[model samples]
Target: MGQGPSVIDQATFKEMGLLSWAIIDLAINWGGWAVSAALQTDKFYDMLGTGSFLTLALGSMAAAKVSHARKYLVSAMVALWAVRLGAFLVARVWKVGHDSRFDEAKKQPFKFWIFWTMQAAWVFITLSPLLLLNTASAGGPARIVWSDGVGVALYAIGLIIEATADAQKFAFKMDPANKGRFIDTGLWSYSRFPNYFGEMTLWWGIFITCTSGLSGAQFVSVASPLFVMALLFFVSGIPLQDAQAKRRWGDIPEYQEYRKRTNLLVPVPKSLFCGASCGPKSQ
Candidate 1:
């Protein structure tokens, strides 16, 4: 906004262009992983994963010749979400000393490197929409479309839901009385994985915001949200958590009952009034 040639208009991007930009982005992502892998600590993965996306989005905008309000707004949203998520996860790992998910992976170099590569992929794929929007030449000055308003609203709701769910779960875990018990209160009461739901929703909202500006091959960026949903639903998020819960409480009648009534990712209205039936069944 202040001065200098826009990143998109710069001679380097003009000559080498998006392909070069993409290679640089890949380097940043892999570089972070390389550092983390050398240090042998997964602590930075969460922070770096989110931070890289923010960097890519903002960096692309900074390179562009034209400054668009929509681009700026999307950048701000990404920054806010990434910061909050990174800080939250970092604090969590700090408290726990280490993430057990890396236990076996870290012990094996090849597997661990694969994990880092996957993180890089996750960053690149999930952020495709914003990255494409920031670099695309189709749109002018970023007008406020109906999709933008709706997308922003969705993002806000998802952020609140995710934050609330995490806070509630954290609080529950802190209490001695709730020891060994799974969280079925607050947002968790409605969905087995409310946090994942919020995450998916927010990404979907982000994708929607980029829709109006997208044209031609740019539409392929819609894979951003779809990839997120798949990752959560089948790959990493839900399956892991669900298995953990099963190991911990599967034999208990209450947990089985809770699993039966509660939706997997979407919150159900019946969750509010279903009470005992919807809640954990008694031991």
Candidate 2:
């Protein structure tokens, strides 16, 4: 949980550039890869990401010269997020025994290495705001502003949505009668992928929280949220999940109707007024 002070000062960290964060990511992920490849498993991949975020957050704060309430608050948030999500995902993977997503990749050493590398990139880009803020030089006594409150509110909303959605799905899956049926109740009725919606919201929330500490070009860390959104929308998150759903239930009218009416990833209230006319069709 604790790391010794960075050997390189903030200035030297700059000289070395993003590589400082890059090295941290590669070191942690590649080390994780070594173990995963040896075992021929990807079960621990998400946990590794959780560890990367915690390290960037708490470790950077420990190595920082500018200590403030913001740093403490941000670091704590990151740690809390890591522990909650990491425990959940790790438990799920262990329950499932293996991640189907890695069925082919785990067999190829070079491909498995690429998966870990991409995971490293996910941590790096996603946690950039925290890294920048934690490593910044002291900016003098600054009052925590209204933005802090907004950030925390957004984060709480996101955390609740994501956690609740996952819990609901898990509960649904545990019921034997529900076998072969898709979840169209609870939060799933509001959004096909409420959990992914929660994931995007929380990352954006963290970015907004870090914005108070940022200025000028440093604001480019906006990629933290944008990358999350893009990754979910254009890349792995939505596409893979959607494809899997179609493969399983594509021919069923009920499943097709569910997709036709449910907002793909955004949670919206379903009502006869909004659903059939505007939002997802109501149950």
Candidate 3:
């Protein structure tokens, strides 16, 4: 298949306050990385996702002469999730180069600038919860308790499912024999977008961890996971991919049959009667 053509171009970054705020936030996040690396907390860093958490920890450690427990936990989770997502996107961008969808949106000069600026703003907005949550944790001593255990379990499960789903899709697409073929095996068979399901659930797990204290700052953390889930399921993730799928397979009877038998986001065991029973022509 031809690489999708760019529909937008000539976009430049705008000097907006929102953009400035986002940059400042990201810079603070970098500081977190510096201290985290120095402290040899690579595993913790990986789990937290963003440098922001580390930054929060560093700042907290400085003021209090000891780490605030809540800050440590929330920052760690935020950093882990952000890093995982950022790495995944970076890899994807490397493989495909500049995202065509983004390129297309940048075609009009004024619109291009706006789009680029919004991209920056979005980064800050989406991550604001983590940043806020981290600061909130710095206030006083907090205890890690049973809720923490539950949250950790949920996070672990979510990560496993999401990672497995992504791996399955990647492997399926890599095989030359599978070219132009729909995947209906492994995790793919379980849910149309198992990765997305896992993604939403993962954030909720993080949210659970952040909210264990039931503080006002913890309330702010709620937005991070909820916003991400909405963005993934509705605004950016599923809608875009589903549009492509419809474009590719809308007219195919086999796709229609598969659609009938499978859930969109939840995994269901493939029925023996449903699979072999579909005639060869449909396959």
lDDT values, one for every candidate = 0.79, 0.83, 0.58
At residue 46, what lDDT does model 3 achieve? 24
Clashes of 3: 16
lDDT of 2: 0.83
lDDT of the structure predicted as candidate 3? 0.58
Which is the better candidate, 1 or 3, if ranked by TM-score? 1
Best by lDDT: 2
Order of the predicted models by TM-score, top scorer first: 2, 1, 3
The residue pairs that clash in candidate 2, if any, are 274-279
**What would you estimate as the lDDT of candidate 1?**
0.79
Residue 74 Cα positional deviation in candidate 2, in Å, after optimal superposition: 1.3
Q: Local error of candidate 2 at 20, Å?
A: 2.4
Please provide, for model 2 over 1-283, each residue's C-alpha lDDT reduced to its tens digit, 9 standing for 90 to 100: 1333554454454443356777988999999999989989998799998999888778787767667888888788878888888888898888878888899999888999998999999999998888888777752237877888788888888888999898899888779999989999988997999999888888878888888888888899999899999999988898999899999999999988887777777788655436447653479
lDDT of 3 by residue, 1-283 (tens): 2433332211111112233345555554444344544542322222223444334433433333234566566556655666666566556555544555544433444444443344444446555544444434243336677767787778777777887887787678778999988887877776688888877777677667656545653475577677877787887688998888889887999887777666677665545446775435553
